[model samples]
Target: MSTMSAKIVHISIDRDWREVYGYASRPQNMPFWASGLAFGLMQDGDDWIAEGTLGAARVRFTPHNDFGVIDHRVTLGSGLQVHNSLRIVPNGDGCEVMFTLLRLPGMTEEQFAADAAHVLRDLKTLKELMER
Candidate 1:
């Protein structure tokens, strides 16, 4: 299988890993940090309907687990689906939250870089919120 290019943007939070995962994994709290879902997400059965990022999209999040995995898939209105891998891992006395951003099909280097920047900003926002 072909592998897509990726960037893992992450931030360290001075909080427990489980606590960070619990707060961050909730859909209701996404808008506060995840700019793409800043407009908010509406529950639609098993998936959530979001109106941010690139127009309207449907997002499917992973089921809650003891492991700090919050992977999700976003399907755009155009049917382009993107998979995001997010994790909260113990780091020192706190935890590290990481987001893997994959370079989607037809994505230019400039676009990929911009996406990475956006993810970094989001992670920073998460760190700030969690540390507060």
Candidate 2:
């Protein structure tokens, strides 16, 4: 399995990072900023399942944030697996949010890089929205 990770720094903690994580982690919020082609959210028992189209591939979000991990599975098309994690640490005047995404076998490095960039952008957007 191929693995890739990226980090974003120097963000003010004016809003709860956890909440930001929750929002970004939601499926319905994808169309707001995610570069995905399509997105949807559905209830599966108690947990919400987030599904979206990233290009021609279908991706699913199975949140495990309670354990500081989020699992993403690409079922249709290019089958892939992603384990996501967000780490928040206080910096000088704000907090640093670090995102780690591990790509499982069948995923390309380019795809991971693109996803990481999109996620970082989404986090920045989330931070801005919460600070407002």
Candidate 3:
């Protein structure tokens, strides 16, 4: 269990959940919208290994499906396992993407804030890419 609380950040997109899930669920597409993972990744079967803002990480994402669950686990270079729970749900005429930022032990308040901001930006990027 984490020592700190988790933060929920969300953004509404003008698209369907299927469309959002189709694009965001793929780890290969991460570099395009996720700034923290913009360095790209190497896929080895079900695992995606990449070096990014948080250092080298091995990521395992949820499989493709109609449900907009884009949850994934990231093992950092420091041996920290972070579980990111992301979801896309229908909202009126569009959809809303929600990202849960889990605060691990030893993480500063500022760092958590920065991570939340980064996720918000990434969601915005996804929206832009999908709406185009």
Score every model by TM-score. Answer: 0.96, 0.53, 0.92
Which residue pairs overlap in candidate 2's backbone?
Answer: none
For residues 1-132, write the lDDT of model 1, one tens digit per residue: 379988888888999999999999999999999999999999999999999968999999999999899999999999988899999999988999999999887889999999999999998999999888
Better by lDDT, candidate 3 or 1: 1
Better-scoring candidate (lDDT), 2 or 3 = 3
Q: How close is candidate 1 to the true structure, as a TM-score?
A: 0.96
Candidate 1 ranges with C-alpha deviation above 4 Å: none
Count of backbone collisions in candidate 1: 0
- The candidates, ranked best first by TM-score, are 1, 3, 2
Q: Judged by lDDT against the true structure, how good is candidate 3?
A: 0.87
Which candidate number maximizes TM-score?
A: 1
lDDT of each: 0.93, 0.54, 0.87
Model 1 is weakest, by summed lDDT over 10 consecutive residues, at 1-10
Better candidate number, 2 or 3, judged by TM-score: 3
In angstroms, what RMSD does candidate 2 have relative to the true structure? 4.7
